[model samples]
Target: MRTAEQVTFGGSGLNRAAQIRGDAAALAQAMADPAARCLPMWRGKPLLRGDGLDALGLIPMDHPVLAAGLGKAIRAPVFLGLEEDGAPRFAHDLSRWEPEELDYGALGSFVDRSEQRHPDLPEDMAFAELRRVMTALSPRDAELAATAKAIIGWHATHRFCARCGVETVIGHAGWQRDCPDCGGHHFPRTDPVVIMLITHGDAVLMGRSPGWPEGMYSLLAGFVEPGETLEAAVRREVMEEAGVPVGAVSYLASQPWPFPASLMFGCAGEALAREITIDPVEIEDAIWVSRADMMTAFAGEHPTIKPARRGAIAHFLLQNWLADTLN
Candidate 1:
């Protein structure tokens, strides 16, 4: 797995200043510093700049959009980290501000092409869905955007303490939530998911969900249940979904998939048998695609099989497999 970190959202060496997360005075100084910049997000979308939406729209802390009552802030900004130049980075949720002429239908689709532009922001800047533009961003921007989305999404969902049903307050510079009533502490959560590339001879296992677009298929994946190892999850998922027993499982690479919050563990496994008996409840359909056909699909020439979305771990693993670089 030499190229493991080379995966889209894994390799960026962003210096997440963890030490300052719990330091109040240090956090204040960093926030007040003139070099601090904030990345504004709206409804899980990060503001992207340029005509191609290839860059993050990081604005100054004192920018007009951040002014009180002008552009609403859902909550205080969460400290992201310091840049290579020592400037502080933070994520601001402007989800409270509603954009005009918003396309409600395209907001949460599998392929949301809609982009939201705030009237107060420049024309070149608009909040674009992260999945739609993840590959276009630089490695550093991808990492930062992913981190911000995961953390902010966590805060949005976990506003109450599980221990006492009391409302929790943001703490640790957005890294933690504290229950004042019960003195309970909760941290951001990242669920582990195993997405495996199962192979039998020269073919691979592929499946499609019920709601996915026609002909769209990807590697079989499932959340790693409690007390289950990555290899065990891969074997169990493949067996349950496609009735294919897997052996000789090995790690390949990983990606930070922040659709909400997930860390995808990409693995490779050898199929014990090729006979397919798909579980209808777990998947709509399952098929064994030969390497040649897979190449055709990747080239967008296959008549009935569409490749996985680019920038996703499934695509990364399949691309490496086709390139003979899984080692």
Candidate 2:
């Protein structure tokens, strides 16, 4: 897994500045400083700039959109970290704003291509879905966008303490939630998932969910259950979905998939047999695709199969496998 960190959203080595998260005095000074910048997120979409929407639209603390309260702030801005020049970065949740003629249908779909614009913001800046533009963004911007989306999503869903069901308040510079009633502490969640590259000789196992677009296939994957190891999860998931026994599972790479907060563990496994007895309830289809057919699919020349989405870890693994670089 030499190219593990090269995966999209793998990491950008951003200075997290964790030492000052609990320092009230320092946090206040940083918030008020002119060097402070914020990336406004609307409904899980990050504000992006540039003609190709490749850069984060970070607004200054005193920007009119933020100062004039154009879009309501759902919560206090979360401190992201420090930039290369030691400037503080923050994420603001502005999901309350309702844009004109917003396509409600596309807001939260399998692939949300809808973009929203705030009237006061510059024309080049708009809230765009991260999945659509993740590869176009710089590694630093991609990491920041994923971090912002995951943290804000956690806050949105986990507003109450699990211990007492009492409302919690943001603390630790947006990295934690504090419960006033029971003194309970809660942190952001990142679910562990295993995406396997199961193969038998020159063929790789692929499956498609029930509602996926026609011909779309990807490696078998499932969430890691409690008390289950990564290797065990890979074996169990493939067996459950495709009825294929897997052996010799090994770690390949990882990606911070912030589609509502998930960490994808890419693992390689050797399939025990080629026979695929798909469980209809778990997967709609399962098949062993040969290396030659996989290359044709990746090239968009196969009529019956479409490759996995480009930015996903599945595609990354498949690309490396085809290039013989999955070591």
Candidate 3:
């Protein structure tokens, strides 16, 4: 689809510097260069230094504040990429800095709001949630943040080898984990999820989970089961959650959802029936709302239903559908 890359976290044609990742000598030189800059993530939240909503922030790699932290890395700093000017970029996960933890439910709630200030950095910087500010960020920044989050999150969880149950060491400039015992190498994993825009005439299928904020309904989604195609996953998820059979599934767009790493495949499917037999365990409620009502919800005018948050694939897909602009 034409709008595929317009989604938050879509690629921005950055040079990932893959060739240098495995070259120890080159990586060491780049790390020592004055052009090296890093984005520090604390408890999964990245530090920020922008005043405007759309600004991009960078922390100098040699800055005193980050120097001490880098020396004490939980692991090697993950190399992000080089900018157009060849400035090296890396992301450092500093969950150990001040001993704060990331609670998934409260991720967007400011990580360093009341923390002690460092003399080297500006005082007004905000470490805001990536999701809450994704729409406001440029596509490039969004992609950078998402990439950093996914790789760092992966390193956080995959500290040991699955095959040998042995400790693994970071390698390939943070892109790989090597296990000495098993002679195994592991890369970051991205879970595949299918989010369906199931439609019956003018209405679209949406559901709410038990713990989501009230009135926050979104496209019916589920992880793609092993050996399942995207279309099959979409069809299966809709049926399992809402008991609505789906047919003629087609791809729409995709988004990289990095709340601990997921690659969301947005799909459209034809709903064969409208009657919902709620699977109480999977979803709290299922409803088919006409395009008109969906518009109202999108505008935040619906009495009880709220639209999917902006910047999410659900919002993007629904907005395009409403305008008949899906390509």
Report every candidate's CA lDDT.
0.90, 0.90, 0.81
Cα TM-score of candidate 3:
0.92
Clash numbers, per candidate:
0, 0, 0
Q: For candidate 2, lDDT tens digit of each residue in 1-327?
A: 889888998769889999878999999988998999999988899999978889999999877676543223235788999989989999888877778889988986778888888899999999999999999988899999999999888888888999999988889889999999999999999999999999999999999998788899999999999999999999999999999999899999999999899999999999998888999999999988999999999999999999898889999999999999999
Per-residue lDDT of model 1, residues 147-185, tens digit only: 989988888788899999898888888899999999999
TM-score of every candidate: 0.97, 0.97, 0.92
Q: Encode model 3's per-residue lDDT on 119-238: one tens digit a residue.
A: 455775545567767888777788888898888888888889999889888899999989999899999999999998899999999999887778889999999999999988988889
Error of 2 at 51 (Å): 1.9
Error of 3 at 309 (Å): 1.2
In model 3, which runs have C-alpha deviations exceeding 4 angstroms?
A: 52-54, 70-73, 99-120
Instruction: Give the C-alpha miss distance for residue 262 in model 1, angstroms.
Output: 0.5
